[model samples]
Target: MRRFVCDCGSPVYFENDFCINCRSALGYDPLRADLITLADWGGGVFRDLQGNAFRYCSNGEDFGVCNWLRPADSPSQFCKACQFNRTIPDQTRAENKERWLVLERGKKRLFYTLAQLNLPLLSGWADPQRGLLLDFIEDARTSDKYPETFVSTGYLGGVITINAVEADDVARATVQDELGESYRTVLGHLRHESGHYYWSLMNPEPMLLAEFRQVFGDERKNYQAALDAHYQNGPALRWRERFISAYASSHPSEDWAECWGHYLHIYDALDTACSHRLLDRSPESMSMSERLRAWSKVSLMLNELNRSVGRGDAYPFVINEVVAEKLELIDLAMDRLRTLH
Candidate 1:
């Protein structure tokens, strides 16, 4: 993420709704990908210093869960990022609002990175044939509404489903431990599931599909059966030699998505490092090989920094030779996906 500052020079954040130093209301302009200090223009409208009129997304105005702005005359109730939300957690429950807030923050961050990459993004509502949708729902784990339903975080059709309970720190940690995961977070889940969405969107042609098979294995393999075998036994032997994570060894598609997610993770982290003057060049200027090389140094420093502060490694997974090859293919695939925009 790029560093942001309030007009008064106080440091702000991507998720900020108000400037601390200037005490000014803030609104994020999705088109510009910038956080701007706003001046109330009256009657639920706001204007920046340049007098561009805007209104808070209905989700923001009503739920305080979003900080994005829409053009005052746009007629859409939601911001560009929020428009993809097909279902939000039921707001009647007191805890659901907080969960929704956390979920929205992750979604906005994911959208920001996707926009930065110049990827095509359309709402399922606008173009159901080739668009994305998000669903934040509750199941037996977090709500009484569904006593037997369990909503897993995943992508299917054109929609990404995230269990709202994943927003709760305790609940997430418990699952993380139960699953023997090294690291997990709301943003991580969003990025990973989005990989699945984009892979489907790509729908690679024969030659490209052949290359995908060469890099990540045959995606035509039985997915559910592979997953069942993986869970019943364990990750394939010597998974670390080829996969980004143990779970990535479950199937070829999972491997592709896992590598895709890591590509985003590395891109964002390297971009942030460059923005903060910790790196000399941005990820955009680097080839896949250069990115992998630079990420090695930066990720090492990141882990050391975390250790200094008494925290565990910020990034626990390693990019091995096989995984690096998969990431390179994913990088190329992203270039093709960008053409759809």
Candidate 2:
């Protein structure tokens, strides 16, 4: 979420493929965690200002759905992030291309935050037992081709499935209303599902698992039955006193993922604030407790800024004492994951 600039002193965005001022081709090099302005070096190769050779990820080159770069010598066609894709939307459909673009944007942002946190992110192709994968697909509700299939945005095994229609604003909003959810977005879904992936990746030891149970409750509890009860009855009474969102009250695993998603949200926002010079220090330099304290003030300012523009609150949930404790556990878990990386 940090601001980027082209070499010509022109501000560029993360998603920009070319600089407006210098017309320099832009590509994000994940290895360097930077956006580099590239010069055409012929034969589909490019060199950055420092003469680092690179090639556009095939997804970017063929489908215009990614902006990441890979080493010119790499055997793989996909970027580190796109390598996680198990299935993408059918690109032959004109509308699916646009939907895939939006989905990729959300996914890239998720990878950015994950990289910033230094978390382990291997592709399922690399490590089928523990690695991650993604599926951007359609079902009966969104396409006639799959008349009996219903795809829910969720994570199972190593794959995260995002129903492609979530990319459509109206469709997502309609589902949000029908489910009586306060907020939902593609990025939110991506972040939440990533929590599941990493949680499975962690496979915590006895001590850490015991700590997690103490903080977030026993994840061993029946997940489906809990979700069924939650939907049939609604969120637990006084859920706001203990959880980040109403849906978080559905299950212990869900509470963990909700807290994990909000942790990323707060960290990314704080990092952006620091990059803009609105904050004196970056979240990386702060402890988990410090970041939470900073977010408490920052979230309020963010809400007020949205109000000034006649928009809804940018962040609608509250992080109560109980939730803060759970987030702290998540922070500790991230630290452990970083060590494993």
Candidate 1: Cα lDDT at 50 = 91
Runs off by more than 4 Å, candidate 1: none
CA shift of 224, model 1, Å: 0.8
RMSD of each: 0.9, 1.0
Candidate 2 deviant stretches above 4 angstroms: none
State the weakest 10-residue window (summed lDDT) of model 1.
142-151
lDDT of each: 0.92, 0.92
RMSD from true fold, candidate 1: 0.9
Per-residue lDDT over 61-118 for candidate 2, one digit per residue giving the tens place of the 0 to 100 score: 9999999999999999999999999999888789899899999999999999999999
Q: How many residue pairs in model 2 have overlapping backbones? A: 0
* Global CA lDDT computed for model 2: 0.92
